[model samples]
Target: MAESANPIPRKAAPVRTKIDHLRLDVVGPVATLTLNRPERHNALSLDMYHQIPEMLSRLEIDRTVSSLVIRGCGLRAFSAGADITEFTTVRAGAEGARLYNLAVAEAERAISNFHAPTIAMVHGFCIGGGCGLALSCDLRLADTAAAFGITPARLGFAYSLESTKRLMDLAGPAEASYLLFSGRRVSAERALWNGLVNEVHPPEELEKVTYELAVEISKRAPMSLRATKEIIGLVRAGQVRDDDYTTALRNDLFESSDYIEGVEAFLGKRPPHFSGC
Candidate 1:
């Protein structure tokens, strides 16, 4: 795989954490968050939802991490969705459902609002809540064997509006309706057609491809990435024209040190060392 323009070598060992059914591995500038319960197809337990926000909050302030990749530990699935075994206890009643729903919303919100870009590297089954998780990411890269679906219809419950909007935004209402209404899994190729995934690679190449993309993105000016993400979100929220804030943001970027460096690097025919100023 190709390295970043301003390459940061791999660490002697990746900084890793093993807790809460999630594993975090931080290399030089890309962090990978793995859903770790492969025994259950990495089914998300209730506590995993609570842990996500907390984990992301830490990463949000860590300047060392410029990009994040989310995936499952094993090849069987990205996730099988929320742990059904917990439904009897964690999502049993109205209040239980409410709390569970709140946690899911918070976790997804954290991902959507994360400072750095997020990529979902999907393989095998990405269903129900798992599909929502992938949609929350800024990008989704999947292997050919990956399958995606929004399956609330099968569960006899309504999907959250926030999650529904995300699906609608990416795949549009018609395709989103098909997934939600039929609860049928789509092949990775179909997912690509629906705009659910950015790319689909052979299973053997997915990891190398995903990390290569993440590393390439990490080498860019951080300020540009952050601003662009925010601006895109604004556009998604119906801000079609530039407002005062957008105008100011654009003006500031032009005056930034990284912008000057980029220009100079182009003239010098050398890679820019972006300090993210």
Candidate 2:
């Protein structure tokens, strides 16, 4: 069989980190952030929620990382959602609930605002806050066996407005209402149809597919990626017209060295090496 014109780049040795219930692994330009409590279906503990923003901050400074994949440590789940075990104590009073909710929002915001593209590699159960985290990513690739749900209605808790908006944007208001009202688990195929997931793969092939996408994205001009991400965000925020900031952003890309390399490489029919300048 003829190989692809742009072959998948060979992966580099992963630099691993042990940060309690979460794991961070970087291989080449791709970083994998794993929810590591597999024994509890990769539930997000209170401390784990607190760690997310800090973890993302560390990655933001590493220019070498062009993309990130957020997943679970095991095949059983992407995340079953926030640890209910802590709800009684950590979310006990009005003050506790306020702080806990703030932590969740901040963590999701960090992921949503990450400079690089973020992919959520999901499998098994993605429920409640787990679904929120996945929705926060730029894209979601799921295993065929994966199931997704948001269950705040069942818990008698109000879902955050940010999370609800994200869901509404991806799956539309009708589908979002159904999920929110029923608290039913939708299969991977159904989720795909509803636009909840970008793609669905067999369990055995999920990792391969997700990482290949990450590598392909990493190969693009970094400035372009960042600019596009921000531009789309602006559009989402109802800024359709080009403002001073957008004009400056556009001007910078044109003046960048990567733009020159990209043009030259295109004319030469070769891959361009982007310096992210």
- Model 1 per-residue lDDT tens digits across residues 1-277: 3212222358646787767799877888898888989899999988999998888887887887889999987778999999999989989999999999999999999999988899999988998888888899999999999999788899899999889989999999999899889999999999999899999998878888899999999989999999999998898888999999999998899999999999999999999999988
Instruction: Name the candidate that leads on lDDT.
Output: 2
- Residues 51-92, candidate 2, lDDT per residue (tens digit)? 999988888989899999999877889999999999999999
Distance from true location, Cα of 86 in model 1, Å = 1.1
| TM-score for candidate 1 | 0.95
lDDT of 2 at 168: 91
RMSD of 2: 3.9
Clashes of each: 0, 0
